[model samples]
Target: MNRDNEKRVTPNLDENELMNLMVDGIRKDGFKNPIETTPAEQPENKKPVIREQNRTERISPTEYEEIFFKEVKSTARHGKSAYIDPVHHKKLTRIVQVIGDDNITIYAYLYNLLEHHFREFEELIKEIYEEKHKPLF
Candidate 1:
């Protein structure tokens, strides 16, 4: 990233355009894990901080839209469930048939439900840990 080419992200940018800019910057500047080879060693002179601040300037909105989504095909992107309750499975199948599999709204609803419960379970686990590991002092 060059200072002459750098542009600040302003509040005036629309949601889609801002997301495109962020995506473009991320896709172009893939992360290099500093932990892979050296955890004990440290870089001198704060090079990582400087590099982080020097983000690539966004391209034009037209070009941003052109590179909107990077086609990342990965086997780990999908998962299969072991089982569903027979009644729920039937209902889900019917819903998919009626609304089509590509519909996002129903899927988002299901995802949100799962996400909310997962967070709840996380907090419960933390509480259990605190109960089991209370400090004496």
Candidate 2:
């Protein structure tokens, strides 16, 4: 049998048919390439993580109540406009209507939120702002 003279018979099966044949043969031989994990082999009680996934410390409802009714002490006021998401705006409006008296408008609610945020991150915010701040000579 001369190697050069012998014509190799190429199988006429399509790619999918060829793959199926190869896979069937491999499976029959008890050779698991990827090693698929069956449901029965896996732990039945395995649970996904359900802990507090908040990025910041979880604030109590009392804290929120305090912030919601906190009096604005700063006399310095600036005229500015804010574009809030429609859904969030609606929610805020509802909250203000429910929790607010004559003193707490949407403006006040947002200002208090900003004030709380600034107070919490005052040092970090100051540092970052100072780094980027330029004084006109």
Best by lDDT: 2
Candidate 1's residue-wise lDDT over 5-87, tens digit each? 56755456467656766754544344322344343465564333322233237456455323322222332226444466889
lDDT, model 1, position 128: 71
Residue 46, model 1, lDDT: 31
Give TM-scores for every candidate, taking all chains together and pairing residue i with residue i. Answer: 0.27, 0.45
Question: lDDT tens string, model 2, 20-128?
Answer: 6675564544443445567677566843335535634677767886976676654325646668999999999888878775457777788888888788779978997
lDDT of 1: 0.49
Task: State the C-alpha lDDT per candidate.
Answer: 0.49, 0.70
Cα deviation at 114, candidate 1, in Å, is: 1.6
Which of the numbered candidates is closest to the native, going by highest TM-score?
2
Spell out the clash pairs found in candidate 2: none
lDDT of 1 at 79: 43
Off by over 4 Å in 1: 1-77, 95-102, 105-110, 129-137
